[model samples]
Structure formats: structure tokens, C-alpha cells
Target: MSHADAGPDDDHPHEECGVIGVWNVADAAALTALGLHALQHRGQEATGIVTFDGARFHSHRGLGLVGDNFSDARVIARLPGTRAIGHNRYATTGETILRNVQPLFADFEFGGLAVGHNGNLTNAQALRRALVRRGCLFQSTTDSEVFIHLIAISLYSSITDRLIDALKQVSGAYSLVALSDQALYGVRDPLGVRPLILGRIGGGPGGWVLASETCALEIVGAEFVRDIEPGEIVVINDAGVHSIKPFSRQNSRFCVFEYIYFARPDSVMDGMAVYEARKRIGAELARESRVPADVIVPVPDSGVPAAMGYALESGIEFELGIIRNHYIGRTFIEPTDQIRNLGVKLKHSANRGVLAGKRVVLVDDSIVRGTTSRKIVEMVRAAGAAEVHMRISSPPTTHSCFYGIDTPERDQLLAAHHDLAQMTELIGADSLAFISLDGLYRALGKPGRDPASPAYCDACFTGSYPIALSDHDAAPERQLSLLASAP
Candidate 1:
């Protein structure tokens, strides 16, 4: 089978990465490397770091996890500086290769700038096309590079002014950390579509820290200060922190999926607990939609919390029906269809004794392409589940996500193609129900809230993209065709 069809869950959406930047530290590269390791779950395809050693900049980038990428002593030893920015990426806009790994460094008239980006740019295609028409060259397909070019051409009197000017023209989600020879800069887009937090370590020799999640700060022993406000920029230098607020106050619409799937459960974003939010989603699922069953079983990992909530709320018995093999690496390859048939079995195995002759209710976070749900259902039935029902904690994902998530095309979404009854048949489930959109928002503690609030961005469910699509239209037909041709 092709890579796209190799496993049922292979096509599920993937969020990009975690970014961490530090200003003026003795071992900037090493420190940033450790920070990236702590935030590695945000992305795992590749890692990169750029450091400013006062006089010049140094960089090391490669395709692999943080440990693998920085494993070579020669590579680590080569990067030296007191100010640095780092990135751990799971490719969303570009191919998973070394060339696309970031901490994208460039040299312009203003000197050198290195950036680590944590979210998607909705207007990148249009901007790139405009730049190309104006005689600019691009080395990678990633949208993050466009920001560098935008900064390169801004006709401001100083580097900071240029950075601000460049930011004004771009739209969409971004939580960025940039390092220059003399300073470190952190910025959040106007709508606050992504998360970026500020923190500080010790004193005197102490430095400022910028990261995508607050957990990274805790891991690095930094005290959390606050989130960098939307449309705001914070620059850290020898003189201390300087703040710039250029855009008008607009409604904030942070992506809700960060709490549901992307973030480390231990992290806090905008004061909401990721783990608590997920557990609440499960509780809401139980209140809004409960299925008759002898046992409640989660899909493993992401599905565990919601399952607990479902079990608790419904007063149903919860059992560990599936066992996950934590040691399976992304690169672990099985050579044939027979071995591949054991895909779910390899990653998760059913407990026949627990599920045998039992009516079961399986809880999963969401169903994107629907391939995995089918296999999961078949596995449970094979393990002697007399009747199997499916419950989802989140609303059906029908629209494609453009904000740094690797969701499949609109046509590829099972919800977009089938209703609940149709989906039940497709997945071989006796019954299926998803939490209502309102129910999900209420679970997140944003019930009846205005859609434009910073509380949540439900674009994947509602199709209300805050940024104008025309601004960065890359020709949807062309993009879809490419995906259709995926191997």
C-alpha cells in the first residue's frame, strides 16, 4: 500500500512544532537544544537552531528528532553564541526534509535574522508569488520563509521598525521567536491564532525565554510572566525588554485544538489547562451523548482522558481494552501487508478477556479520514465485542485546517462525506455520535460566547477562517490534485 494508505491512522492531522528562544546566555545553543527536547512532542520530523555569537551567527539543522539531529558532537560544537532560537518541526507546508527545517537564517542589509515559527501563515502563497514576481528566489516550500523576505525589504529606519512593518502586511496564525546579533524578538499575530509565552530565569546573568508552550519554560526553569499579547512584539536585549503594540485591539481566536490534541497536557495556554480542557470535553461528551455499553474503552493516548470522563459521568465500567506499545518509533517499518495488517495490533492490542462477549463503547478524540476508526472497530469485533458503539468528544471535522495543521483535504474528511448513520455503517459501529459544536465550546468554558472571541477558533468545524483566503490563495484545486497524487 502507498504511504497514505499504509495504516488507518496514518492520515490523521499533525500539528507542526514547538519554538524556544533565549537572549544572551553562555550556552545558548545547548540550552535551546534542551528546550527543544522538552517540547519535542509538538513536532518530530526535524530540528534546527541558530545562534548569534556577538560577532556572527552559527547554525545546525537536520531531519530527525532533537536528540538525533543534535547527536553529532561536531554539529553541536559548531553552533556557538549568547543569543539563540530553536525549532522542532513536523512539516505541514513543506516536505519532511533537512532543507525545510527551521531557525531559518538570512542575511539582509540590516545584518542577520534567524526565526523559529510555531504556526501557519494563511497568506504565504500569495506573498511568495508576489515576491517571485518581484524577482525574489525561494529555497523551500514553507510559508515561514516569506516572513524573512518581508522583513528583508521593509524600508524602515532600523531593524526593529523593519520587522514591525513586515508583520503588518502578513495575516494568519504565528507565534514567532527571532534572534539577531544584539537582540531576541517574540511576536504574536493580530488575531492571536497561536500561543507564545514569556518567562525569565535567574538574575544578573539571567535571560528571557520565549516558547510556544509554558511547559517548556517550566522545563528550562523559567518563571512564567505572561502571554505575549496579540499584535504585540517583545524585544529582549542587554538594555532589557521593550514592548511594541502596533495593531488595533481585535478579537482573539486561539485555536481550540491546541488543548484537545496538540499541546502537552502539562502546558497552560491563556490560563486554560490542556489536560483539564480535554477531561472536560470527555465530561461534556458523557452529558451530551451517552451510549449503552458493558464497558468503556478509549482509543489510547488522546482518547484516555475523555474515556475516563465518559465512564465517570455515565457510571459505566471503564476497562483497559487496548494496550499500546510505547516503544514503537515512527520509523519502525514492517515489510508486508500481513505485517502491516497488524498495524493497530502492533501499536495497540485488544484485551480479549476484558472485551469478550461485552457490549462496548469506544471513545476517540475525532475521526478525520475515518480509515483508523474502521480498523479499530474491526479489531474490537475480532476480539469478541458483542456490540460496539463509537463516541467522539469533539465536533466532526469537516473543513480543512490552514493554520499549521496537517488535516486532509475537505473531500478526504469522512464527516464531510457522510452523516452519523453513514459513518456508523462505514466504521462498522452499531451506533456513532459526535459531541455537538455548542457542546464542545461549552466544555471549553466558552459557552454562548461570541465566535470572534479569543477563547476559541473553531474554523475546522465551522469554516469561519478569520483571515481572508484570497490574500494567500495558492489555488485549492492545484493543492488538492497534488495530495491526490500522494504515494
Candidate 2:
């Protein structure tokens, strides 16, 4: 439920990437393309798919959205195979270059192996440096490539063993799909910090599909079987699905932000509908922070469901005080240097008629940087909003995420520096409130967060990283060197 580093101008959280795989299926590339399309929201910068027709492996990867890269019938036809893996990429560890687009293929002494990965490898820099010292030549800066290097150097008995051996060395979250001649494999981290699911195409005769979310399964007519458990490695092929536990099991800590924002409303994670969880968060927020306002206005899109929930619970009318332009690209360039902060207005416009003279509560998912909230408040004020009260569906993001989500350092986070009163003044809002940490847990059908042992990963909110940050928390010189290597 995180994205790559958006520039300071954009100032919002992003999903790092999305992944999908299919085995023992006809037109595997076409089906994979469809699945990636369903998960397009997770990432939009690049797309790739690798397929194997029991002998030769084929792949087509490019920079752009899934539809832009794989829309053509010719593009899908080129990757002919009964087994395939695909990724929608936003480039968390690597730079935004074509060589980094994954389904990263490598030929091994045993056979050909292609891998598609989601989530960041927390220990990647340390591992990369060690691998480099041992005379391994790197092809791309992607932490995913470390898997290939580790597998090549592994002395394991089988391909699966090699994969597990490689996984054991790395730390941090990952939900991966890999293709081999004999089978397709899916793996999740020990704590299930990321998401992965298992689904079957038909009742029995058809193949199996693996994706980061169940919503992708529905796009290709696959039925949800069950979630791939944490520390689980599953093999899918003509013989059917087989499960293996290669890592020591640990406490489950699924990323909680997935429910509040990242996942699609229709998609279900950990057995709860994402949309419903957000609605419950909104309802709880209304109870905790009641305000006198003429109407409730959503920030648009991500905030719509939560706003609806707030309205339902608080008995306040919800209105579209702000409208979003559906087709804005992920990044934009300013046509003129003089036009400051045009980026925000390019995507959103205030409805003057609706907002004028109205005391409004603007509902949004979270405020990673106060810049976005500040800009929105300014626009609403310009539209004659008498009072602007800001309500966030999640707790203030005070800490940085080490697992996979690209976030500013703790010092750069708005909440890390500003108290609630200061945040309200900074954002120019009459009032401001965030769903309490306990309230967020309650919305997810859990008792309040247990400080001693939290059930979910809330590092960004609590500053308690679940895993060790071997590389990031290293010497500043090392971190600078790693970033230099990326470009």
C-alpha cells in the first residue's frame, strides 16, 4: 500500500507496484495483461510480462501504463506460453529507467528463471555491496536483481530450494511471482507485510492465478481460493497447487494502510472489504471529531467512500464541493515557470456554487505532507468556504515506512514536526482531526492496537519499524552512495 518517491510537488503516498501470474493456461500473456489492467491503480509507470511455452521463454516489457504498453494484440501474442508472470511498476528501489522494468529474466544452469517482485528489500544495499565484493557484476540497480544473483550463487538442490535460500538472506517485505519451465511460484514475506492471493481459473480443468489483490482475480474470471499465507511458497502447474513453508513463521503484520487507501474498494484483504473498512474508519472519525459545518465534502476519489460513511453516521449531507479531473498523468511539467503550484489545480477544481458561504468538512484518507491539504484548503477558501475543517481517515503519518512504501525521512514528515494545533494553523483549516490509532484498529474489526505487539504494520504512524533497517538506518555516506548507484 505504498508508492515510489513522488516529487515534493506531488506530495502524496504512492503504491510501489502490482504483480500477477498464471500457470497452465492458454493465452497466458493476454490473461496476464487483463489482470494487470485490473491492478493498474497500484502503479502506472511501467509494465512487463514473461511467459514460457514449456521450452523457450518470451517477454515484452516497456515503460508506461499497462494498457499503453500491452493493449495491442500483437504485443500479447509475442509472449506465447502456458505459464507467465507480470508486473505494473513504479520503481521503488531502482531508478525510473527501461532496464529496471521487471519480470527480470535470467538464464540459469538449471533452466530459465523470470521474476516479478513487489515491495522493497530492506537489506538490499547491504546485500548488494556484499554480492559486489564477491565478484558479481550487477545488471540493474533493482533489489529484485539480488534474487537472481543470490540464486545463481546458491548451492541448493532444487530451484525452489535456491529461491528459499536467496529469500533467507534478504529482509523486508515482498510478494513475488516467478516463472520456470516446470512451474510458476508465488511467495510472501514471513510477517505477510505485503499482499498475495491464490485463485483458480475454473473449477478444476483450468489453471491457477496469483496476484497482489483479489480484484485482479475477478477481472480474469478467476475465483478466490484463499490468501497465500505469510512465510508461504506455493507452486502452481499442471499437477495443481502445492504449498510449502520455507521460512520460519512470524507474527502477521499486514500493512494497515491498504485498508485505508491503497487497495481498491471492491478488493478484499485479510477477509475484509477495503471499502467497508474505510467507511468504518470514517464513522469512527465522525464520532471522535464532531464539528459544526453546513456540509461534508470529500477530497474526491479516495475520500469519497469515507465521506459517505461520515455522512451516514453523522447525519450530515455530503456534497461534491471539489471535482477531480479523472485523466491527469502521474507527473506533470509546468508550462510556465511563473505559475507556482499549478499542479494541484490541474487535477482538482473547487465548485464555487456549492462551496460558497458554506462551512465545510473536507474528508481525505491521510496527510503525508501538509502541502496537499494546504493547497486544497486554499482552493476551497478561494471558492468562498466560510469555514474549512479537515478530517483524515487515518492517523497522522509521522514516521517513514521501511518495508516498501517510499516515504520522506521522519524529519520531513509534517506530523513528525507539527502537533495537531500547529498542523491546523499550517494547513489553514479551522479545525483538523485524524482517526485515532485505536479508532483505525477498531474499524478493521480488531481491538485497539497493542503497543507491546501490534497485529498490523503501523510503522509510518507509530515510528516502530517491525523489521530491522539494516541499510537505510546505516551511515549517511552509504545511503548517498546507494542513491548515486541507482541513477
Candidate 3:
């Protein structure tokens, strides 16, 4: 079964990708498959693995879950190599198909190169147009493919230099793992809006690994070493792991949404556990929006931990008032709108006995479009809850994300279009409250988001995007030359 439970009404921010790389392992491909499985929450649409044998590079990519694609021994055996890289894709940047399945591979003049990227490149369209003008042929529609074109066109001497050249020209969040015939490179963008970590296996002569989260490292039996510093590159090979800082350092703006929804609960990000951070968020929310309720009811699955934290903090009883159907898959044949609207019941059923005559407080991570939240609220009210108060662990999602997350446009986002009162009415809740921006940072163990040194990227809440939206802001006839510095 898929670790991530989904339904037809899963209208929330979609995750982008999960990347893993291993060097000098006997079961490199197999270990990568396992790592991707552990990080499956970050993506679900497709899976791909690229292996480098002593003689040649082998690749296997397909449109499905990791288990669906890499379950067969034949598939892993087909990719025999001492080193490999893999990707779990969610189609945040490109269409969902076999072609868009990554670690995208290309044969350069130097040798074979495979790239696994975990964030969006903001300036890809401009770069693609420029590359095409310079006679570069494209294989995939993915923005990540532009890196290959840039690297291919560079007059730099070494592979690392060419990669640096390509990276310098682009803008936005990324935690990239790139593997060539001789070396594996792990790089995080200057802003560090995404996550990447390095790990060490038990043995030597290339026991180093790179993954999107610590959970992937644990799954591969690799000990966590450290997070790849923002604007830093670590090149791993038979010799050892070497760190290179090619770009100017900037304040790290790690995505706050990762702790709230994207990352696995078991994973640790930059010295803090994701589950603990979420619980802290819940406690903060309880303090900010205290409501008179007999029981604290979670939205199930992701909201369970937070609900417990809220209950503990607010002195309310935490109960499973809503039961989730974990077996429900993402794809379901819908015959009509009536059946589609029944998606909430298909994935979740309200426990009438627990909710009857009780003032229940519903705790959830965040409401994207308020579609599912509305359905869940209506379902609970129908189940006899006297009053349903909705509490969100994060700030209102007022802006769309351009840094890997698949969020609706500003016009489509419910929070962007409506005020709290309007949103409360739309979601059919007695009251609605989302955590404040400062409260979110407090959950991460900080006093608050310091204006001078804001740590996490709260762009979805504040609309202060650190990276430029090149494509989104470009004029139809604006032929910007991205061959220079950052566009």
C-alpha cells in the first residue's frame, strides 16, 4: 500500500520531488529504491532510477508509485552499478508522463550525467527560450532539463565548473543531486528554500550518500552527517567527499511548509524533528485561538499529532472523531458529480457517537482551496457536532508557491480571495483561525521570525518571495538573455 493516503478531493498544495544518490554501494540501485520509498510522501506520480556501471549507464523510469515501478527484482537487476541516483516526481514543474520521470539522464561530451532535482527553477522558461535560440534541442518539458542544456553549452574545463556555471545562471529553490561517471555532486541553492542532506554509510571508498530528507538516509542505513549548506556543493567519489562553495552565501530560507506538511514525520530537518515541530505548531495554535470545545478532533492522518498537541495544551480531550479510510487511492472512476462530492465520505467518515452534542475543534495543517475542509466540516456538522471550530496550524496561504510546491494561482487560492470571516463561511465552520506568521517560526524553536534574519520561507503567507518569477513575470515579446549572471 502507498504510505501517502489520497482521495479525489485532495485539494491541497502538491509536493514536488524527492531525490536520492548513493556512491560505491553493491546494491546502489536497490538502496536508491528503498530511499525513494521512505521519501514517498514528497511525491507519488512517477519514479525513476539511473545507475552507472563500470562500462555504461542504465536507466529505468515509469509513471507510478515507487512500489509499482521498482517492485520487481528484474527492474533493479537491470540497473547494475556501483553508483546510482533516483527521483520520485509529483509533476510540479512538468506534465506527468514517462518522459518527465527523473533522474533525467543525458550524454555529454565528457560522459553520462543524471540529475535528480527536488525544487523548481524560477527562470526555466527564459532559459529554455535562450537555449533554443542557441540551437539546443530539448528532450523533456521539465525546467530541470535546462540545467543539462546550460552545462552542455558551457566552455568550462571540468564537470563541476560547468555545473556551477549552469547553477549560477538560474534562480529559485533547489536541492539537486547530480551523478556523472566519475563523481556524484550534491548542491543546494543559495536561498536553501528546499532541503538536501549528506550521509555516510558503514564502509569506506565511497560510502557517502545524498537525499532529500533524513528518513531516506535511515532507510538506506546511512548515518546522517550534515545538511548540505546553502550555496554549497559536495562532490563525492572514490577519493572522498569535497565541499565547494561556488555561490555567494545568503540567509537560509528553508521552506516552512516542509515541517507542516511536505516532510515525513520521522525525518529531521536541520537539527529539529519534523513531528516535534508540528506538535509545537499545534500548541502555538491552541494559545493563539482558544475555543470552548469538549473534544479536539483532528482531520485524520496528518492532523493527528497536532490535535494531540492542541488537546494537551488546551486541556481538552483528543479523540478520533473522524475515521480515515487509508485504503482509498488517488484515482477513482467518478460517474457523476454526486459521486465526486461523496469523496469526503469515501476517504473519511465522521464518528457520530463521538461528535454528537459536543463542541469539537477541528485541527488541520492548512486549508488550500477549502474544498476538502468544507466537505469535512459539513460531514462533521451532519454527524451532530453542536459547534465545529476550525484551527489551522500554519498561516493563511495567501500566495501561490513558485518554488517547487504546486499551489493554485492567487485568484484561485481561497485565502487570497476572501477574508477570515468569508473563509469561515465558505468552509462551513462555526469559527476559523489560522496560526500567525510569527507563531510558525516559534514552533521551529525560534523566538519568532526575526525581520533581520528570517529563517524559513513563508512566501505562501507573506508573498515576499525571495526568488524572482522569471517566466510568470515575463512579457510575451521580452527576449531576456539569461547567458549573463542571475536573471
**lDDT of candidate 1 over 370-445, digit per residue (tens):** 8778988999999999999999877888878878777887879898768888999999999998988888888888
Off by more than 4 A, model 1: 1-8, 72-74, 203-206, 334-338, 449-454, 471-487
Query: Best candidate per lDDT, number?
Result: 3
Question: lDDT by residue for model 3 over 1-487, one digit each (tens)?
Answer: 0136543468678788999999888889999999999988888989999999988999999998899999999999999998999999988676886777899999999998999898999889999999999999988889999999999999997999999999999998999999999999999999888999999985765688899999999888999999999899999988899999988778889999988888888899988898888888999999999999999999878887778889999999999999988777756625678878788888889999999999999999888889989999999999999999999988999888889998876667788779999999999999999999888888788899887778889888877778887887685432232121111
* Ranking according to TM-score, highest score first: 3, 2, 1
Q: Candidate 2 — what's its lDDT? A: 0.87
Record all residue pairs in model 2 with backbone atoms less than 3 Å apart, i.e. clashing: 2-14, 2-15, 2-16, 3-14, 3-15
What 10-residue stretch in candidate 1 is worst by lDDT?
Answer: 1-10
**Number of clashes recorded per candidate:** 1, 5, 0
Residue-level lDDT for 368 in candidate 1? 90
Off by over 4 Å in 3: 1-8, 333-335, 476-487
User: Cα lDDT of all candidates, in order?
Assistant: 0.81, 0.87, 0.87
Positional deviation of residue 73's Cα in model 3 after best superposition, in angstroms = 0.5
